[model samples]
Target: MQVQPLDIVVVGGGAFGAASALELAERGHHVTVLDRTASPHPDASSTDISKMIRMDYGADVFYHELAEASLDVWEAWNADWPRALYHPEGFLVLSAREAEPGSFEFESERVLRERGYDPQHFDAEHLRSVWPVWNADRYPEGYVSPRGGWAESGAVVARLLKLGRGAGAGFVAGSFASLLEDGSRVSGVRYVAEDKSVRTLKADRVIVATGAWTPVLLPWLSDVLKPVAQPVVHYGVDDASRWQSPVFPPFAADMAGSGWYGFPALDDGRIKLGHHADGCVVDPEHRGTVSEDHLDLARVFLAESLPELADAPVVGTRVCLYSDSFDGDLWIGEDPERSGLIVAAGGSGHGFKFTPMIGKLVADTIERRENPWLHRFAWRSLAEPRQEAARMQH
Candidate 1:
């Protein structure tokens, strides 16, 4: 932990950037964070009403352990933070059929039991008896862990921004135009200021946490880091309490199969659902839009999974973007080609939950400390994107 304070500039004040700035600044480093818009930018992926926070990674023990550790932090944050950002409503995962080898539910149950956690397993009869809202016949097998639930993602990001600013981290509003380099070393950044005026920021080191825009901003990474657009739907209902009730926790129905998962109703009477399958390629410039087919899929999922929600009116939709890597691992650590530059993008789809813990890991990498998780996140060449089977991504 003993290191000289270095002037650092972090691009993108979303979850990753804000957390990094907070951690770095707390370590007595002069940190400046720049973003194209506000801290909880409406366009940013992490700005959301709710996001799942769970330790279920199927057979991947690394993330399970990391998630459990982060859960402890989330519990502390729940007590310390003024607002309710973390929710321990628990997470329920269902499968279309009985447990089979290599299936998401099966593997998750296997791993959880191995770790000595008592996950409640339900059969068709039990599921129907306990959760009458669900069409238990279709999803006859499932499990619910009291350990996992959802997070108020946007509020958490805003809270981190406030903490960073309060801890002496400078904040700037701008679009990343280019990086200021001294020969092969990155010195700072040149960006379009909030007033639309071009400005240059100088720093000893720069960390790029620009999420989906990383590929477009640094084209060399396009082959390694890809940005894709996924669909999420929010439905309007008359009895909000029915949908937002304590019994209705965040659950996935055939997630790795149908890629269907949903959050309980928000305070605004809207129930959110998302598909976690491979999203379509998108350009962040013009941006992606939700198509009729995507909405139709949402309809079909509701009809099959939650019959009561089948006829509910569609309130809103989002073409959410994911920074996917060729191998589904995060892209972090210093760029081998560029000195004084660190790359921390590629959230895939499950990165938001790690906001409470990623900062320390990212800070460790930035400070040149040897971290056990570095090898998986380091820059590498993957011919084709192979999303890990351990995590449920439909």
Candidate 2:
């Protein structure tokens, strides 16, 4: 338990903010979530039709464990809710190489087998038996995990926001104006409301989970927290149901090399394909438009992978913002300079999957609990270069 009850103001009511608010409020803290838009902001990274929910993180055991546990929670959420948000359609990992060293697919299959999860490898002959859409000549080998799929990300955010509010957590929607501080100690924040009226809200502790906007809002941390824009393309398919049938699941094509991954068709018959590359550095505030080069790249990928979608018209596109840290790990701890401030914004694109566990860590951090993950996430500095441990890093 915390030493005393805290008045916590969580900035950015997306995945991190809503989860933190719910956890903190459940732990008896007076929590309020301040979002720039409605709690589930459409522009927010969390507001998507679907996101991959796989327990595969290559050789990164920590994240492997995290996702494995999270999958269970997502299943539990489906059981608890009347309408299911999670889709256990399975995840297909197409590898260009056949179990090569340092390969993402090889590492993921190795780890899953070690952990006693049955992940099946499929060569060309085996691949043709299960996957109807798989290009045998293009992808000689791959693996399938039945426990993985995608989730209704935006709907999940809305459900979590509702849960947090029901647990006595207040939510205020408007853009964040500025920090309310007293000599390096942040007391709260000043925000501009929907009516253009300015209001000052006080808190014992301020947690900034504002995603890619974190660096722009707090300029001092700009070097470490960079806002990168990743391209997302949604295509309207005529036979959407057939695209995601049991034979054709959600998959990544030569994930590490091409960074090409896609989801099954949504209820609206739209299929979303997103790349996991390093992405372009962009200002989060003015980022909505995707470049022509990205669209060209998408067409090229579909031509090579799915010939059927070679000339498919693009229905939607978004330059989704990712709050990337210097290293590819999450940053969730107190600011060294500020007395009552906590920094918890770095998602690095693989964050939304950990929605089940992140809030508990935030709550535990505030209570000063000794958690093993704290060692990796604590405030620190290092010169090591960014490493790609997740299955896809282009």
Q: Give per-residue CA lDDT, model 2, range 195-255, as digits (tens).
A: 9999988999999999999989988888888999898999988877777747667888888
Per-model C-alpha RMSD: 1.6, 1.7
Model 1 agreement with the true structure over 58-116: per-residue lDDT tens digits: 87887787788889989998999987789899888888988797777888788888888
Global CA lDDT of candidate 1, please? 0.85
- The local distance difference test score of each candidate is 0.85, 0.84
Model 1, residue 7: C-alpha shift (Å): 0.7
TM-score, cand. 1:
0.97
In terms of TM-score, the best-performing candidate is: 1
Q: Give the TM-score of candidate 2.
A: 0.96
How many Å off is the CA of 155 in candidate 1? 0.6
Best by lDDT: 1
What are the TM-scores, per candidate, against the unseen true structure? 0.97, 0.96
